[model samples]
Target: MSDVRQLLTSLQFADSAFPSGFYTMSHGLEGYRQARLVSADGVQQLLADLLLHSVGPGDATALAAAHRAAADGDIELVQEVDQRLFASKLNAEMRTASVRSGHQLIDLGAELIDQGLLAEYGERVRLRSTPGCQPVAAAVVYAANGVATRQAVASDLFAFSASFVGAALRLRLTDHRQAQAILLQTSPVMEQVTEAALERNLTDLGGFAPMADVMSAQHERAEARLFAS
Candidate 1:
């Protein structure tokens, strides 16, 4: 029964249909497309790089930290993890995308999950005490819902892929079949990244995706865009 609950919670948080505002943000994929730097093959490469370099050491590591902290009833540490992750995001759109999605997730989770911790954290976010990045919000929800930390990180990373692929399909970068292939090929990379992310401490919560940051910054000033980031 506990296993079933965990699976359901993971699925709920990961589902694209969830009102986490995930569909509105492309997470820098739009910038790559506008720059003509992405083909179908490049889509796979970008996802792999993001999983390993950007998302793994940054958001996934923060999620693991927040999960452990929440488990130990340490909300202060969760805020610290969230702030560090926010500071590491070099692009404004990147930070906005994460904070927006995270705020929405916290709002929805607090209403649905009956978790006092989320409510308290939501207050902190309301007070601007924390940036309330997506990973931290995910960690809090997963911990409250009995999902394991590794699974929480994995789910967050997968949700990111789903959002990126959705953007690619809309941008006409890939067809449905090719998008499916991208997800299939990227699954192993996601697994490996998740493993590494789980072993990271809060001090290891930084990323080196210079190109992604540049692209994201460009996206912020684009004349037009299909996605927010």
Candidate 2:
């Protein structure tokens, strides 16, 4: 029964339809497409790079740290993780998107679950006292709801991959089938990233994707963007 509950929680948070607002942000993929810096094949490489450098050591690491903190009933530590992850984002849109999604997750989780810690965290987010990055909020939800740390990270990573692939499809870089192929090929990278994330902590939450950061900064000023950064 515990396993089933964990699976359900993971699925609920990972679902693209969960109103996390993740669909609106491409995390700079749209900027890459607009500059012609990425093509169909390039999408796979870009996703792989993001998985390995950006999301892996950064958000996923924060998520793992936050999950453990939450599991230990350490709300202050979770908030610190959230703030640190937000600082690591580097770009305004990237930070905004993360906090926005994080708030949404917190709001939704407050309604869906009866966890006092989530409510307290949501209040902190609402007060603007903390950055409340997405990974930290997701970790709170997963940990508070009984999802294992590794599985929670894996679910979050998969959701990220899906969002990126969806962006690629909208950019006409890849069709539905090709998008699936990209996702399939990127699974191993996600596993590696999850493993790396699980071994890291808040102090280790930094990303090396300078290009993605540049694209995000550019995307903020792009005259015509189909997606937010």
lDDT of 2 by residue, 1-229 (tens): 3888888888878887879888997878899988899988899989999999999999999999999999999999998998888888889998888988888889888888899888889999989888889999999989878899999999999999999998888889999999989999999999999999998756778989988888888999988888877
- In candidate 1, position 184 carries an lDDT of 92
Candidates in order have lDDT scores of 0.89, 0.89
Query: Candidate 2: where is the Cα deviation over 4 Å?
Result: none
- Estimate the overall C-alpha local distance difference test score of candidate 2: 0.89
Candidate 2 accuracy as TM-score: 0.97
lDDT of 1 by residue, 124-180 (tens): 999999999999998998898888888888988889899889989998889999998
Instruction: Write down the worst ten-residue block by lDDT for model 2.
Output: 198-207
Error of 1 at 81 (Å): 0.4
